[model samples]
Target: MKRRPRRSVPALLTALVLLAGCVLVTVVTVQLILGERPWISYDAVAATLHDLHWTDLLPAVAGGVLALLGLVLLLAAVLPGAATVLPLDGLFDSGAARGGYRSTLRAAAAGVDGVSAARVKLRTRRVKVRVETSRTQPDGLTDAVRAAVTDRLDRIGPATRPAVAVRVRAPRRTS
Candidate 1:
């Protein structure tokens, strides 16, 4: 079935850039504090971080966590409809046919319009597909990923719809 185009993400790159900047700043701040040099300056401060040890590592770990959170938030905010988060074991957890089916679905998704990359994975009973698209809108990308995945799975044979979860991600090349 033909689909109607929805709003496109003209400002996605801008939003992502901002998100990245935020993450960078946050991470730097936390890391510098952990390093015993919280201030940003031309001259390096007396950072006797050798004594910081595990406590210092907390910020590094937290920075990683915060950065991950930032990226995840950015992705969800920027591409909500296109990306679906599912447990890693959802799709192919059952057996080979299901695993293979998901692979085929991923390949088909990769071939769809606006899709730059496709990753299909099965976790338990869920089929999660992460699709990288040139287009940024989550809704539009989700629709495309959904349709493509559904069509591909249907073509595979008379089986269930297979919990088709979708995620639309901006192409890494653009970032």
Candidate 2:
């Protein structure tokens, strides 16, 4: 089973723009039918459009801007976002499970000796663990963190196990 895709921001913005345009047109039409002055003067707009030329700088700039906006919206709608859930061996998957998996891996890395702080990044094919320690000689810290994280990943039993990479950083000493 695949995770549900998240809503696109550009798609939402496009909907809002269309809704606002429809509301504006409806209000103008109702005002015109009631013989009341509309918010926007149609006659003036018509006159301006009639007098405007395609070669004019303003029209060219406006057309270019609109084209660019359309292209951006189209790309945003067509692009797929990053995966949100980690697939398991069976047909079971939930947000809670993903969170638990991440936390478990992070805890395992942080539990290693000489690791003062641990940060884990879970990707589709690789898990990166960054550990910070105050020890001057952090020789075996990276291997320890990697082994611990790998062990946890094995226990979790994800459908596709990601490779684990560990990096140990020690705080710089000040003179």
- Per-residue lDDT, model 2, residue 105, is 91
Best by TM-score: 2
TM-scores of all models? 0.39, 0.84
Question: Model 1 clash tally?
Answer: 13
lDDT of model 1 at residue 58? 72
Model 1 lDDT per residue over 71-167, tens place: 8767655653422222223334322344455678888888887778889886545679988766645457688778887887666542234578887
The whole-model C-alpha lDDT of candidate 2 against the native structure comes to 0.83
Weakest 10 consecutive residues, lDDT, candidate 1? Answer: 82-91
**Model 1: runs farther than 4 Å from truth?**
1-99, 136-139, 158-160, 171-175
